[model samples]
Target: MVHHTMTTNSTSASRASSRISSMSRFLVLAAIVGMLAACGSVPLPPMEVAPPRPAAAAGTPTAPDDGAPLPGPIVQGRSRWQPVRWSELPGFDTDETYEAWNAWLKSCERAPAPFAALCPEVRRLSLASPQEQRAWMMQRLQPYRVEPLNGPAEGLLTGYYEPMLEASRRPTASQNVPLYRPPATLGSRRPWYTRQEIDTLPEARAALRGREIAYVADPLDALVLQIQGSGRVRIAEPDGSVRTVRLAFAGSNDQPYRSVGGWLLQQGLLRDASWPGIKAWAVQNPQRVNEMLWSNPRTVFFREEPLSEFDASFGPRGAQGVPLTPGRSIAVDKDSIPYGTPVWLVSQGPVTSLQRLVLAQDTGSAITGAVRADYFAGWGPEAGELAGRLKQPLRLWVLWPK
Candidate 1:
């Protein structure tokens, strides 16, 4: 029997790992249509004029944070920031500003140049009233409507979460699927062996000999763990002890990601390419499971990390190198919103409604576009359900210190 203890991390995998369940699996249809639509991608037009700036604070001006002169509207690779009034933000005054403070404080752990100077004040306000926090934000920062270079302010918002599973420290009859650490020859080639080659080629398997971190019962579970990039695994050890540990993204085979769900859809295998749907298909076509698994050439490797009482409270380190707050942390395209920036997000959809402050503390490969974001829904089955179904429209406003 596998022992069940739990640990976690807030690393890059949490941001990008849920691609399997979050969007790639469930939104396969959309992905197919998008691929068809992008066959003739063309250059975008120049950005438009900026909106009117918000009214200045009453007090006399002080030098901007970082001691740099306040620049005008900024343009990013895929997005543009157009100065706008605080009032322009939807439900801005009603959000529980203090709830977001924790995420902001985490961002300050590795705040970028523009926000590093503001961390002192951010820390001081941790205990301040919600009203006070909101006031400080308006007084010190300017709100910018984040829009695409040549598109609208609206974009896609998906969701991701850490997965928890059971395992064994060593291979067993049931737990035959092995999770691996990086191979010594991982980088010997431009891109390490593909997932199929790793399974069928003796040379590829030879390279990974003795690199097994743990073994699980189901190949699909291993695939899900790899997709999530980091997960909590309850392991039954040879010492007759069961403990939970985190599997973090150590490295990958360097192959481009290919969604198996999308591949299944393309093959006319299933219309509902969500995780459950894929699982059902696998059950029906047991002999072809490898064919489905191999659809994604990319194979991610992980290293085990000990989970502690305090560490369990937060998520794996994100791309920004900080533990992510469950509801308040977000993965944005760094080119659109730099890591550590505070963003005002507004989205209303069937699953939920959100009008609050979130931190740009993480990033994912699929989380591109100016207003696009991947909401971290936390861990466990409930979070998994939400992450699986959360695909919605979104708008964004970034707050920069004045």
Candidate 2:
């Protein structure tokens, strides 16, 4: 058995190591996908978006921020923030089993690495028996502070395989394809969000003006590597009048992008640890496991590193250090501030401006309340810096979720 242990005073350093290790496995899987493709061609389907449900009212939900009174029903400047009854959200009416599965899927989508690592445990619990699965799920759900509720709400749950567009030359190979994309941005179209619109909404404005929201930091041990295997390269127009355009790639995996944990398990890098396993592992090995994983070559960790340090190491090559897209930030409904909601996160820290949106997405175990959330700062040294210096306050308004 692999004795995954290390001694480190810095929690962040340990996490970086674990992330690096997992990334190595992810990359290997990607390579396998590339090798299997014929003539290096893998076709992907167009992105799809789920329709938003109507908002309903039920008992008052807990506030994500400090125990402040729930925000008024006014959401964006244009629409009233109707309360969403628990019944209206995704698993309210479902049986306990379905609810458990839904939570698992949501958690997997939020943080593929940790969720993937926990997959084996989830499977074991689910396989043990119905009662066992329920018990297991309940134990898992405790950390997230999730509970049954009654109400109706409306919002979209989107999933997709985002391919990194390379700097040069399109590759003919397999790559992960996005499972969903809102109809508006499908095809070669640019997406946009307006500052004016964001400014007008009371919730958005209040969130912006208030002190930076301090989310539950993603435990370093829970971090997993997202390896870019081989696939087709799709290019978008290049930045700044340059003749060369940026290219994006995708791999062929029939599984839905939302099943991130399943994807990792199928690749065999992570065991099914389930929710309890994940929580336990995180709590126990926060520092040691992180260091081991980060030291591994197959992984690429997401974290913030000091600018000076980053500059000294990667230098000019470091521009690609943090993945950012113009006008692109993770968005979520104020009511269900999903864990891991990727956001441009406009505040000063290791990443001030640029296309970085590290700490927005939420892992299910961590996601609770209408406005609660967790941000994913990429991986490795860079991610560490951002995570440490992340003391500024920020308010976020979703551009597309609207």
* CA lDDT scores, all candidates in order: 0.71, 0.25
lDDT (Cα, tens digit) per residue for candidate 1, span 1-402: 000011111111212322221111123212112110011112322323334333334553322223344357889879999887665777775788898999999889888999999999999989976666777887789888898998544676766667788899999999989999989998799799999999999999999999999999888778766766677789999998999998877788877666666667678887645555666788899999999889778888887889999888877778888887888988888888998999998877676888889998877775778888878777777666666666667878899988
lDDT of 1 at 85: 63
Count of clashes in candidate 1: 8
Deviation of model 1 at 297, angstroms:
0.7
Candidate 1, residue 280: Cα displacement in angstroms equals 1.3
Model 1, CA-based lDDT: 0.71
For each candidate, what TM-score against the reference? 0.83, 0.21
The superposed Cα distance between candidate 1 and the true structure at residue 44, in angstroms, equals 20
In lDDT terms, how accurate is model 2?
0.25
